[model samples]
Target: MQTIPAGNYLIVFNENGVREINNLIERNRYSSIFLICDENSHEHCVPAFLSEIETEIKIEIIEIEAGEELKNITTCVDIWSTLAEMGADRKSLIINVGGGVISDIGGFIAATFKRGIDFINVPTTLLAMVDASVGGKNGVDLGHLKNQI
Candidate 1:
């Protein structure tokens, strides 16, 4: 199991990591919590998450179009708009439930919404679980652009 330590933050990892999301949320006293997922994750993970979380906190699910191409400024705009419409605020917490694309875009969206918010990565893919999710490097790649700016 891996532990993500950042300032006052501590996240534990394990096979049943997904099951503990709600408890962790409660412990943190997050004012609001939502799940941001792509089509694939909505189908593959949501049901299991729903079964495990036992809380009265309203759980909002926001599903965006699934694909690497959908990870961009436009996608963030759409998600941010939706969050606004749903009355999400600075105290809100976002749980990203997908692969690298979702984690990156969701992190960016949460980062910008109401200036900033808390985000947890519930990465579903092997690449995300092993690499992208742990590195803390999040941003959409500029199309047709060189790595060096």
Candidate 2:
């Protein structure tokens, strides 16, 4: 397996990465688990992910519409609200599955919610796999502009 260290976490590649995920989850003993996925990843990747995770942890899947247009403060608010409703505390873990949009916004939500929770990104597209899913950078656009601070 290819392991690229990114800050506190490792960006792992290869089929064995699933085993790595299981190991991380087991080691962390997170209070709860939340998965963020766009429509594409929800359909394409969640099943494979679910199969790979051997532990029977209670996982809540959050789905957002797939598109850059949905990446905004409104989406973040919805995600934050969902986490609150689902009782996600400081010890919860957020797994972001999908392309760059899911990873970026999911990371943002995880970082801000409950004053920061642990999150991992599983990129499902070439662009995201190469760029957005690694390096721990995440942000949303400001209206028509892109990557606005």
Candidate 3:
């Protein structure tokens, strides 16, 4: 896979995305792996995602409710607390695997928790895939307004 450098992270392409994800897992030695997904993605995307990843590090699945209605400060706080309770540290890695809601909230959680940890988005839907492929767009809605928080 060809890695296109983007700021502090790298985007893997030109090969099987999942295979590259496996390679990345092999390369990094994280203390723990956190896979954050909505309930839907947890059912549809996670099995394949878990199978492709060959990591011995414990993977904690943090499943959240889907939809924009859930993408708020409440959800962020819940996920933040969950990360703390799940033993996430500075060296821990977060993998967001779901749609736009996952990408937005997941990135926000990863960026804020513990003064920022590493996170990679494995977007499931077409909208999410397009959204995650780009860099540096992360925020949760503030009430009815989008990207407000």
Candidate 4:
């Protein structure tokens, strides 16, 4: 098990890291749990994650379209709306599962919702594992401009 200390959190890299996730959830006792997945992660990674994480806590899944094009304020609004509709409170945790796009957008959603909430990144791609999931950099493009605040 490899663990990298990132700011206040520990990024554990292991085939069985879902156990860590379970432990974190149990330890934190979050009020609600949310899983944000892109279309690709929903189809490819969600099953594996679910199988590995053994938790009685109910989890709500939010699926978004996969692609950089969909990473924007619109998508963030949708995620925030869903979280609100699902009764997510300040103690809710958001698990982002997918590649860079999912992590970036999902992290943004989690960070902005309820003035910020706990979030974990489950990067499912090499690009995300190497870059997006490490730095905690999250943002969306503004129209045709990339990463335009």
Scored by TM-score, the top model is 4
Q: What's the TM-score of each model vs. the native?
A: 0.87, 0.95, 0.93, 0.95
The ten-residue window of minimal lDDT in model 3 covers 128-137
**Order of all candidates by TM-score, from best down to worst?**
4, 2, 3, 1
> For residues 56-82, could you state the per-residue lDDT of candidate 2 as single tens digits?
779999999999998898899999999
Question: Residue 91 in model 1: shift from native, Å?
Answer: 1.1
Name the 10 consecutive residues with the lowest summed lDDT in model 1. Answer: 140-149
Q: What would the per-residue lDDT of candidate 1 be over residues 22-125, giving only the tens digit for each residue?
A: 66777778777889999899999988877787778888999988887777776777888889899998888999989988888887777778988988888889
- Rate residue 69 of model 3 by lDDT: 96
lDDT by residue for model 3 over 47-129, one digit each (tens)?
Answer: 98898787788789999988889999999999999999989999899999999999988999988999999888888899887
Query: Residue 94 CA error for candidate 3 (Å)?
Result: 0.4
Instruction: List the pairs of residues colliding in candidate 1.
Output: none
Q: lDDT of model 4 at residue 81?
A: 90
